[model samples]
Target: MTKPSIVFLHGSGTNADIFRLQTRKLAALLQPHFTLLYPDAPYPSGPGPGVLPFFEGCDPFATWMDDSSAAAEDAYWSLEDDDSGAARLLESVERLVREEGGGGELVGVVGFSMGAKVGMEVVRRLEGREDAGGGGVKVVVCVCGTVPYRGGGDVAREEGGRRMLGRGVVRVQSVHLMGETDPWRAEGEKLVGYFGEEGRKVMWFKGGHHMPAEDAVNKQVARIMLAACGKV
Candidate 1:
């Protein structure tokens, strides 16, 4: 049987390199069962002095929008709705799936921090689009992130509520890995709870905003993601 493909979207301000370690291990362990693809984010590096090219930025290192600071909030909101860059990325995924002869394969997504946010957005977008292939992103593994605009006030709730409702009564399995003391924990749980009690998994670790680089945590995360995808 042909293996299902896994697409890795790096966090904001970071590139595909973030997934290199996880992908290598997962490919070895899940050999012949999964193929991995790590794509670069769409935005160009923002202007700044002393920037280490790709090595400088905030936590999870992301720039999902043109002007990171100016339109950060707006970018987050528009990410799932309809953005040219995001659309291009999704198109690339579709092409890859078809090219690999796995148009309806059991695909999974692993996203860290900002990438996790984007992954959730992608899932939300896929929920309604009939043209989307690859079996509806079977499982999603989100590390150190929460639903967009969940607690920003009434506007946030209304925006999130719409997407949640548009998800349309379908339960998608999700694994949320958060730091035990990570400030985002409460919000993360709220995001999970919004799923309405179906195939939602949560794990808390002793770390910060970034995913721990420990071998054990990486392995465990991969396992959780694969299991959610029905690969284990």
Candidate 2:
């Protein structure tokens, strides 16, 4: 049988490599069932202080947006609903999918923090479109994520983002893993709610704003990934 492909998206001021490190064990667990692709964010480097807390020692990270300051309150999430940059980001994902997925389309996506916002936004963009069928992402996993806005038509990257009602309902099944002490816990809760009461799950683990490193936690996360790929 052909293996499925899943994209791993990283948080702000961090490249795809960081997420790989964070989920190394889980990736190993799911390797047999799915081909995991970690696409590096295209934008160059971002503000020094904007880096994710877990990546404090990492150098010269990349970000999905052009936020001048990485302040938790100031940093905005979501693909600008009507911006060309959003299209570029999607194109980048598709390009990498074409190259790494071996002519196969992405089956699902797992994102962290800012990347989670991207995962959720991509689902919104593809909703009701022709791409919603098979070979498209059917599941999304957001780890310690924030909410995205949709009402405003043309949004700038630098705009202050307020959590508004999402533009369209997300038809994909989703899993949200939030940290007990994570600062942006509410945002994750709200995002899961936006997905509606069905086809979604929300869980809180012991920790703060970072992927759970415990072996048991990783195993559970792997099961989620496997289930997403219809391997379970």
Candidate 3:
């Protein structure tokens, strides 16, 4: 049997480089049983000094999009092009899986921070049959991502709830790592609520926003993810 493929998506601001340590550790332990792919985010470093764009209106160390109107336009364009960085990420995963001969049965996605949001969109798109060949995502692992941005008000309600149905109810297991003191902890909890069971798990760390401070936390989270992938 082919090893399971685990795609790792970085959070905003930070690039795939940040995952080098975790990937290396996991690969050492899970190799011959799992394949790992770490893809960079879609935003470019801004002209300003010391800036990484990962999302609009939010910049946490690195970002996936900019908050400006022009940045929003760029983001929309990037998302539509499919050839944008995000598309390249999807393509890279597909290519790696094919090269490894892993087939589609063992494919899964793991997204951190902004990447988690991107992972959700990928699941939504794949579930919608938006891909060229009509493939579905087997499992999604969201580390610390927010609920996909719904418009607002009733529109947001309708979009968030109704849009998920299009994906046909695939297995979605969410792992929220949050610090009780972290400002985003509440938001992370809210995101977990959206999973509505189906193997949802939350792990809290004593520290602030950066909870996975030690190898123990990483290993624990990896174990949860592996189980979610049915690898354990």
How far is 139's C-alpha from truth in model 1 (Å)?
Answer: 1.0
lDDT of 1 by residue, 1-232 (tens): 5667777776555666645653465445555567776766766554222224545443243345442343434544544456545565566666766776455463677776667766765665565563454246677777776555544566655665576556553356787878787666765666665443577778777776656556677677677667766777
What are the runs in model 3 whose C-alpha is more than 4 Å off? 22-28, 46-63, 67-92, 99-106, 129-138, 150-170, 214-216
Residue 88 shift from truth in candidate 1, angstroms: 4.2
Candidate 1 vs candidate 3: which has greater lDDT?
1
Alpha-carbon RMSD to native, per candidate? 4.9, 4.9, 6.2
Number of the top candidate by lDDT?
Answer: 2
User: Which runs of model 2 end up more than 4 angstroms from their true locations?
Assistant: 46-58, 67-83, 131-135, 149-166
Query: Using lDDT as the measure, what is the rank order of every candidate, best first?
Result: 2, 1, 3
Candidate 3 per-residue lDDT over residues 130-225, each given as its tens digit: 346775455666655654442244454455446544435434566667666666666577666555476767777676554256667668876776
Residue 231 local lDDT, model 3: 69
List the global CA lDDT of all models.
0.61, 0.70, 0.57
2 versus 3: better TM-score goes to: 2
